[model samples]
Each structure stands twice: as C-alpha cells, then as structure tokens.
Target: MTSSQIQVPAQEEGGATILEIGQQPDAWREVGGETDEGLARFLRGITERPGLRVILTGAGSSAFIGQIAAPALRRHLGCRVEPIATTDIVAAPRDHLEPDTPTLMVSFGRSGNSPESLATTALADELVTDIWHLVYTCDRTGELGRAHRDRANSRVVYLPERTNDTGFAMTSSLTSMLLSCLLTLGPAGRGNVEALAQAAEHVATLQPDIRALAQSGPQRIVYLGSGALAGLAQESALKLLELTAGVVVTYFDSPLGFRHGPKSVLDGCTLVVVYVSNDPYTRRYDLDIVAELRAQLSPDAVRVLSCEPIPQELGTATVLPGLAHLDDAQAALPYLVFAQYLALFTALEHGKTPDNPFPSGEVSRVVQGVTIHPISPSDLEAR
Candidate 1:
C-alpha cells in the first residue's frame, strides 16, 4: 500500500534535505581524496605522545559521529578514545576532563557554530593543561573553524563546502566529517573510499522499497546494531524522530542489549530494523536477535540489513555487496544512508516538512536556548 508520496525536487520544502542525502556519495569521494600534511603531523604527534588520550566531542547529531568512529579509532590508534558529547563537556567538564593527561580533543561540527561546540572546546583548553585540538567542520567560516584555525597547537580540516547542509538535519555534513576523521586519524591505509561511496550510492536506489516501509504506517520504529553499528542505530533513530517531528516514536539499542528489558517496547504497530555485523562473532549475536524478532513478529514487521545474505527462512535482507570486507565502522556509512532515506520518505508519509519539521520553531536546525556559563579557576578549585 502506498500513500500520496511527495517527490524530492528543488521546489519542495524537503528539497535541501533530499538533495543533501543524495549528494553524500560525491561529497565522500571529495573528502576521501583530500590530503593534509599538517593534519597528518598533528595526528602523528598525538600518536607518539606517551599517556595521551583522544576525546571526540560534538553536539546532537554531530556528537553521534564520534560515537560511530570511536571504537575503530581506538583500535587503530592504540590509545584511549572516548566519544563525549559537547553537551556533557559543557555541563560537567570536571568529571570528563583530565588536567594532567596529554589530550587530543577532536571536535566534529556541521555548522561548527553551536554554542556548545565552542564552549566545549574552550572548556577543554582551560581544563586540559597539555592539550591539542583537531577540528573537522563543514563550515569554513563557522566560529569553531575560524577560532581554531590559526591558534597554536590546533589544526582544523574543512570538508567540501557543499557538505555544509542548508537543511535542518545533518546529512552530508555528518557523514563527510566522520569519513574525513577516520581517514586522517585511523591507520595509514586510505581504505577503499571509492567502493564505500559506491555502496552508499546503492543504498540511495533502495528508496522505493524503503518508502513502502514508511508508508506501512508503523507508529513505532526500532533500529538495532552491534559495536559501531550500535552508534549508527542511535543516529538512525534520531533521523526518524527529527524528520517526522516526533510524530513517530523511535528506539535504538545494541542487538544484545535489547534483550535486557528494552525489547518489551515492541508492539503490533512497530517495525524493527536490524543491522547485521560483518564480524563472525558479533554477527552471531546480531542474527540471534533478528531470528528472535522474526519468530515473534510478523515477517513484514521485521527487516534485516547486512553486507552478505542470510538464510531465506530468516526473512528478507538488503545486502550491500563489496562492503563485507569493511570494518563495522566503515560499513556504518552505507547503513546510515539507508536510515536517512527511510527517515526522509517517512517524513513525507506523515505529511510533515522534512526540511523544517518544526515549523513553529520548538526545535531548530542549530540548537538554541543554551547558556554557556564560565568555568572560573576558582570553580575548578572548589570542585
């Protein structure tokens, strides 16, 4: 069954978002091809430093990039890597910062103008005595890039200008920064950037099937994954919530974690989407949940996405070929594109404007109504 679908064109309200979502493949190609010697030196220095810790920070959707990249970055860099949101750093700097540790704070921003974005970086400078800054932003003119560009001990990498999404949600901007960060901070290999982009392009073609899923009128949506894909699930859930303007309730959990009481949210009106892992060990747990959900729910109510095909009796799957060799983190790029497309068509299904879901401005493109309080040296002393 199909509803009156709103096509994506320049004239529609969702045109920017639709175009941005489609532009990701090209944008990724550009980011993946870019090389920066200074940025390399900055990262190389961090890797060589003894007792160094890397902290990835951002706000809202921007923050999820860190969550998606942290595990792989840690394994490749051989150091402590943590994904701490800029919101958390702003609200509770003391708990997350280490004054004496040699730290490299990687900041990911779409606009790079969010109050928390600047505030968190400022707090890191004040709190971490021996610290360096690595920034990835789509906006070259944004305060986050401008403020740190010329500063000593700081290196800023600006992604392709088009990645500065004009739409309300972070689409190309999020994925570009995540890709650039991984290519720069991860191991020496540049990876198969062309293949990754091609996989994302393939996901874009699945729009028709995805739109049908959206049109099914499920009141609840759940996204589940394991490892880095778990973080991808969080971002996937956010896309649905943002595009639908909170009309559709969404939940995200790790495949194994869902068994611990979180699975009770399932109902007849719910649709469950699972991202099966490429790792042999992790795939076992991911498939276990998918099998369990298929047994309990109608086959139509569950969907599985994997890099390779699963058993037919387990149910239908959207298999992204050529990506089976990718680590879970790299695989997240195409998985995210699928989630974005589903969110877009779902927004149109509900007759909501994808570009600006909240017409009344209850929520905004860049967050509003945040007050960044100054953290004085005395405040630190008291704590």
Candidate 2:
C-alpha cells in the first residue's frame, strides 16, 4: 500500500505525517480539556494507594513499552516498579507476582485482545489481593477493556480513536501509549510532555531520509542503547523484523555489552543504529562503542547511523535532529519515530505492503495462540 493509504487524520502539507499516528504528542494537550477529570481521577486513585508495587505488562511492542517506563516510573513515583512481559507472566507466573504485594498492574495493548494480554490480566486477578488494574488499550470494546469495566479496582483508558491504527504494525498506538505512560508515571516536572510532542512533530517531517536508509538494503540492522532505552533497542530490532517479514535479520544490545561478542555481528552490509543517552556518564560508554566501531571500520564495511549526533570522531551518520538533554523517554520518541519509518520503508523495499507486511497471516496485529493457566495458592504466597 502507498503511504497515502495510511495517511494520518491531522495530515498537514508540511507537518510530520508519520509521527501523527498513535495519539500525536500534540493530542495529549487535549487530554485535560477532553478527559481531564478521568485522567485526574485515574492518577489520584493510583497515587493514593500506599505501598503499591506497580507492574507494567504487555506483549511484543507492548511489553517494550513497560521496559521503557519501568526505571522512569521508579525514579518519578518513588514506588517499586517492574516491567514484566505477559508472555513470561503466562509461562511463569510465580517469578513475577506476589500475593502479599498490593499491586497496581498497568497493561498496554494496541487491540486489547491478544491472548497473552487477556491471560496476563486474568492471572493478576486470580493471584493478587487488592488488585488495581489500569488498562491502556487502543480498542475500546476489546476483551481486556470490557472485562475490566464496572469491576471494582479496575479502570480502562481507551486511546483516542485516531490512535487505533489499522496497519499491521503499530506506529501511532505505540507512541500514544508511551506518552500516556510517561505522563502518568515519569518525572513530570523535568519537562513538559507537550514540548516532547512538538518534537515528535518535528521528527515526523524527516520520514523520507529515515525511510531511505532502510531501503538501502543493509543486510543486518543493529540497534544499541543503554538504561531504559535498552528495551527500546530490542523493540526496534523486533519492529524491523516484523515489518520486513523477517527479510532483515536484526540484533540489539547495550552499547557496552556489544563489545564482548556481539560486535562480531557487524559487517559491510550491516546498518548500526545507536540510541545515545544524554547523560554525560552514560553517553561516555555509548560514545566509546561508536569510536571503537569507527576505529575498526573497513572501507564499505558497515553503515552506522547514530540516532543523535555525537562528536565528529565517532564517524556515523546522525539521523534525527538532536533533542537538548530531554528526559530519556522523551528523547527516545524521535529515535523511535525514525525506526518506524525505516521499518515501513524496508517493507516497501521488499515489494511488500508497508501497511500489511504479512499477508499470509503468519503474524498479526493482535497476537494469537496462547493459554492462560490458573495461579496456585503457593504462587500467591510468593508474589
């Protein structure tokens, strides 16, 4: 399908159309005007619960959302925060949940109907006492949202209608839920979420260049990050694989971690995308990796794109315009947007539809095939 086929509702002649999917950052400004009372009430309920251990859960891209939010939530809310994938929670419940822990589980899902999504929610209900559920889902009437409505200690926040993207891959829904999580749980005073949204608008304007890199056919893609973005690296890798129908082999690792053995994966046909942190200490390690890679570069060995600009010595193409020391999650959006564009272009490059890369049905928008198991009493005790 052509890019126009997936055009966003707020499409402007020169504004960023790619970034407009999933509740655009600008759309959050209307949160209070449109649903302020609900958001306020939701926040109040979550914050009032003393000694609450928050578990953020989802699958695939959804799961990565939790990964990005976990550390920031802990730092901002001063609560015990954990990011557990629903897949893991379903396969092994005892490791993640504890009966005695007064838990608040925030679920992120695009369609709200993945079997693992349902299984994770059901397991939480079965295992925890004083359970509070906050579901952020794109589908308003999907299983997870409907099942939790009117139930005590359960609330569902359906994303804006525009965010319910029909494309096989998630673009708008991911950013919307991500922003929602950041606003609700991150260090709010550090920066305005609206400013971050505006930045997203800026990045959206650069889709053409970002998409070109993906179409250039670098045989492999490596995504690197540190701290909260470590999870983002993994998600970026997965997105490329899914959007390209696994035509591209992608890998992810921490900046420092890559040197141990993974660095060997780099070669002439690889495209290395690094998500550099703004923290001076963290950036040092990330920059070191880039320097090492450059030092080892052979003519036409690999094409490296640093998501943010680094010192010239690093020798890599900087893709997105730099954000001045924004919070990691906020900074991540620009990088994430670029990655999405790359995936879309990669699908197109392979003579595949950018909107629906998997036509034969091996993969899906909402995942399929899973079983939810009962939580045992012993499992409850250990949570």
Candidate 3:
C-alpha cells in the first residue's frame, strides 16, 4: 500500500517514526534551499588550502553519513577524504589525528548532543594546529551546535527544524545532513535534490511489497552494496537492528566482500537485499553477486534495489527510473528509502515499537554512559 494508505494510528507506538520517515522528501528540498553562499564560500576556502585533508565524522547512523559521502567529496575537492567515526577518534585520537595537517572536520549529529561527537571536536582543536569545522546538526540548541556557532574556526549549519526527528531512530535527520553535505561540499546541485526527492516519493509505492516480505518471517536480513553504497548497506542494517531491538539478526557488506567469507550467513530463513550501484563498472560486481545468489537460493529470496532495470531472471526489483544519471553517492538518498521502509515494516511485523524499541533504556536516542576522558598536550607529547 502507498504511504497515505498505510493508516498508522494516532496513538501508535511507532507513529512518530512513520511520520518522520515520510517527511524526508520535503525535508530534503529544504536542504537544497538552505545551501547558502556563505557555507559554499567557507568550504571553498578550506579546499584551496595546501596539504588539506577532510575528515567526515559522527557516531552510529550519523557516522555512516560520512562513510557514504567521503568518496564523492574526495573526488569533488581533489583532496584526502576520510570517513572516521567519532567513537574511533575519541578512543584513539593519535592514530587518526595529525598535529600539522590542514583538516576540515565535517561533524554530523542528529541531536547534536552525542558525547563522542562533542569530544571529537575538542580533540581536533587540541591535536590539529590548523583545523576547521563544518557542523551539520538538527538541533540548534544542542551542545555540538552551541559549541561551534560563534567559534572562529567553525561554521554551524542547522537543517530545517522539523528534520530534527523526535523518534528513537533517525530518519529525516540522517538524509537531510547527508544531502546538505553533498549539495555544499560535494557535486550535487538543486536539480539533483529535486530528483532525489521525487525518487524517494516513488519509494513509498514499493512499501506494499516490502511489507509483504517483512511479514514473511525471515530470521536474518543481509544488505550488500559496493563503494559508497557499502556504507548505505551499513546504515540499512543498523536501522533494522535498532528498530527491532536485537530481535532480528542483521549484517552488511560489499557485494564482492561478501563472497570472501561473509556469505555463509545465507540460509532458507534469510533475506538478502542488494543496493545496486548506478556506475556501470561497479554495477557489474553488484549484478554478479545477485546472479550467483539467485542460482543457489530460492528465486524469491533475493531483492534488488536499483536505478535501472536488470535481466528478467534477476527476480523482484525495486527500480527507480529517474536516478540513473546521478552517481552512486547522490543516488544513495532514494536507495535508502527502500531500506528504511523494510526496517519499519519488519519491526511492525515482529510486534515491536518502531519509535521506542528499547523502552527499558537498554539503548537511548542519544547515547548514554559514555565518559569522555581528558587528554592533554602532554599526552600527545609523551606518545
């Protein structure tokens, strides 16, 4: 059924989650409109610097945004681009930070209050002699946003207020920040944003089939992709795990990477979803795995999410027609909608609350129980 026909109850446990997921299309448009000249000028100045390296960071789903965007940004800016998680940076600052490298830290946070996110910014200042920040967050009042608003070396770009998702899982917030980064720092433009929004609206039409599969009772779900799409696969896996509160097992990997050893997770009770890349060269590897899996598994066991059509023997496909021109990084926005829907329906089918899956506080919307240890200049010198 279409999104309008899904009929979520007013007081439903996952009502907010469903609403937030549906709101992404419009929120993305706002991202396009909000890409001001000042942000673009700031980024241009940083990219022109000698010996520059860009690091994209966040924690959890927020971190996945950097993974998906780094490849495209690296190509656009012609500089070193790395996607490092705030969790990793906080735990091992010396490994990822350089004392003299000119670096731009693009921090993505839904709530802007994640402890690791906050700590990583401070650590960058302490560790890097030449550092700049481009902070993208949903909450204006959040610590990350507040901390960087007036800083000399940082610029805070707040997305539309509604993009600050109230649900336990990030739906609108993730895509909004991702699109903002692409439009401002990467090669995406207003036209790309419009196309992505249209494609995401079309994803709602596939929900009926996605919901059918969710109800079919698969014990395990696997997502596979390549390049930037591999990061999309990772985020897709997290959405399912978080919404189900660990009731369902999930895994993610690149299509070729899966064959090395990870493909052993496949079984009659498992479902595999592949995010097909838009690039012709990368699409070859994606199709190879889909072909191999269909040969060994049930014809209905594998699903393909792509921008173009495949051979008839490939089984069911969710083909979004207008996205063929965009590269895999830009195409990632609509491709993610399908994954989001699958996770939402799977949680509903399993009788879990999509909004508050971990009601007992096993996990929280903003992470909990993290202690940001103090690190000094002496700590770096001793090392």
Candidate 4:
C-alpha cells in the first residue's frame, strides 16, 4: 500500500499524485525548452515603455511561487517587482495599484480556474489605465489562460499539457509553471535553458531514496529555510498537509526565526526538514539550527535539504543532485521534488489517498466558496 511497495503509474493506489510528482523533471524540461512568442512580444513592449511595474500575484501555492521568484526577478529586471496575493488585491485593490503607472501583472496559477486569479486580473484591468497582463498557467483551457490568450496587450505562457495535473495536490503543475515563467521572462532564459532543463532531469534519481526516507513515520513535520527557500518550505508544509488530509500537523519557518519560538514543537514524533541555503553566510545559520535541533531532539528528528552537499558540520542531508549549479530560484524547480515525494509516500504510509487526499469531500481540487466582493470607492476611502 505504501509508495515504495507499488510500481508507479499503476493508478491503483496514490498513482495520480505519484505519477505527477515523478514526472516533474520531464515537465520542467518540456516547458523550459519551448520558445514563447507571447513572452517575447511582452518583452518588446516593455522596452518601449518606462516605469512599468511588474506585480506577481497568485493564490495559495501559486502565490508562494511568486514570493520565491520576486527577489531574483527584481535584481534581473532592475524595476519595481511586487508579489501580492490575489486575495489581497480583491479585498483592497486601491492600496496596491497606481492608476498612471503602466503595470504588467504576472499571474501564476496551476488550474487558472481559481476565482481569485481571474477576479484580480479583471479588477486590475478596470483599475489601471496603461496596463499589460502576463499569465503563467498549466491549464491553457482554464479561464485565466483562455480569457486573454488572444488579447493585444496581454501575454499568456501556457505550460505543456502533461504538467496540467489531475491530482488534488499540484506537483508538476506548480513547478512547471514556476520554471516556465522564470525561463521565459527572466534573464539567460535563452542560453541557459538546456542546462536548467538537465538539472531537473538529473534530480529524478533521488526519488527512491527520498521515498524510503519519507516512510519513517513521523507524525509532526516542520520545514525550514531562508530567503526564497522559505517560501518553498511553506509550500512543502502545505503539500504534506493536503496529501495527508491534515492528519500530519505541519509547520514551516526560516532557520533564524525557528529558534525564536517555533523550536518548541519538536518531539520524538517530529521530523524537522531544514532547507539549507547555498550562500555561505546563510548556510552557516541553517547549519547552526540543524546542529542545535539535532543536539536537543533525537538525532533522527532533524534532516537537512539542499542542492549542495551537506557541510560536514550539518551532518546527514537529502541532496537534490546538480541543482547547486543553478541559482536558488532556478534550483527550486528540482528541490521541489524531494518534499513532494515525502508528502506522497507519507500519505500512503498513513493510509490516505494521495490523489483525492480528502475522501470526506471536505476539500476539492480547485478551491471553492471564496466570493470576491466588489471594492466600492467609499470602501477604499474608509481604509
């Protein structure tokens, strides 16, 4: 019944989630190599303008993808880049937008059908005058990708169909879209595409070991990292919670911040997964926390995750191979696979269905019951 016992793609038990997670390397390669005419046209348009703001917005996991990429994007683009959640945009639009500033809102979504994705896009169009939109989505047929595919000023990057997942939790869909946007719109996208694609493919070999490690049967999981990896840590925590149907209590935090108060959560039943940074300065802090936790808790309670080899002082780790060659933002595409496998196998080990996760119908694949109320002028003024 566990993932290690069953052959993958069997579709008998946790197959959908497993296959989606397993095929992420291929999905990244598929989207990363493709050339995008829409993104090219958007780049051309941007060069002609001045002071165009780029806002990266999404909901849930998609929003975290923006948070992971925004810092690097700002450094590359040398323009104002902001990652705002769609919920915030719909709830209070006035505070985030400047009417005269020509803005390019880059929206990231897996299904592109989530109500807030389209709601925020539409709201931005109505509120801003000189506006352009770029949507990165796995589902080209979904509302967000479909509505503006042919728009004159809008650009849509539709990832390969294989990345459009059927599982309740997004695996390929999330990573593929994130990788696609970074490659299509970010710097060195043209030349470095092949190497980046290979980096993801090389990481596939780690799955078996990771699957075995995930079967250790920890009831409480904590994921920690810093900078962009911190966002990935949050996504990893959510992925496990969703797959286990909330049976496994999960938490995510930065290495330095974990000491302030979050450290108290660890016990014998806990597995603290620390995502160590590649930067020397940040890596010291990450290793320090891992050492601190290892000394305080059971030795098996702490695990380090990184693209680079674990420093000698950090002890044992789960390394995603060849990812260290890429930057942290690009490295996230491969590092994502480890946490995904952990969540998937852990789901099966706990007697939960990875595909549906919540058989009780408490949660659905696409989110529901979120009504985006219109922001009246008076409501904006009241704030």
Q: What TM-score against the true fold does each predicted structure earn?
A: 0.96, 0.87, 0.96, 0.92
Would you give me the overall lDDT of model 4? 0.80
Full-model lDDT for every candidate? 0.89, 0.73, 0.90, 0.80
Per-residue lDDT of 45 in model 4? 74
Worst 10 residues of 1 by lDDT: 1-10
Writing each residue's lDDT as its tens digit, candidate 3 over 1-383 gives 54446566542335778888888899898888774777778778889998899999999999999999988999988999999999999999999999899999999999889999999999999889999999999998999999999987899999998888878888999999999989888888787888899999999877788889998999999999999999999999999999988889999999999999999999989999989998899999999999999888876888888999987776768898798998788899988888888898899888888878888999999999999999966767755
> In terms of TM-score, how similar is model 4 to the real structure?
0.92
Q: The CA-based lDDT of model 3 is what?
A: 0.90
TM-score of 1: 0.96
lDDT of 2 by residue, 1-383 (tens): 44456544321221232434424655555432244467568767776678989999998999999888787888878889899999998888878888788899999998888988888888878778778888898888789899887877888888776677776777778877877777666764324656666666665676676666765778898889898889888889998898778998899999989989998988878877777776778888987777676667642333443435667765655544446546676667656766777776676677665555677878876776665666566655633
Where's the lowest-lDDT run of ten residues in candidate 4? 3-12
Q: Candidate 4, residues 96-212: lDDT per residue as tens digits?
A: 877889898999888899999999989888889988888888886899999889898788887887788888888888888788777766653645555655655655676666667
lDDT of 3 at 283: 96
Model 2: how large is the Cα RMSD against the reference? 4.3
Q: Pairs clashing in candidate 3?
A: 1-208
> What's the number of clashes in each of the models?
0, 5, 1, 0
- On residues 164-233, what C-alpha lDDT tens digit does candidate 1 reach at each position? 8877888999999988888998742466788889999999898889989999999999999998898899
- Model 1 clashing residue pairs (backbone): none
Assess the local accuracy of residue 288 in candidate 4 as a C-alpha lDDT between 0 and 100: 85
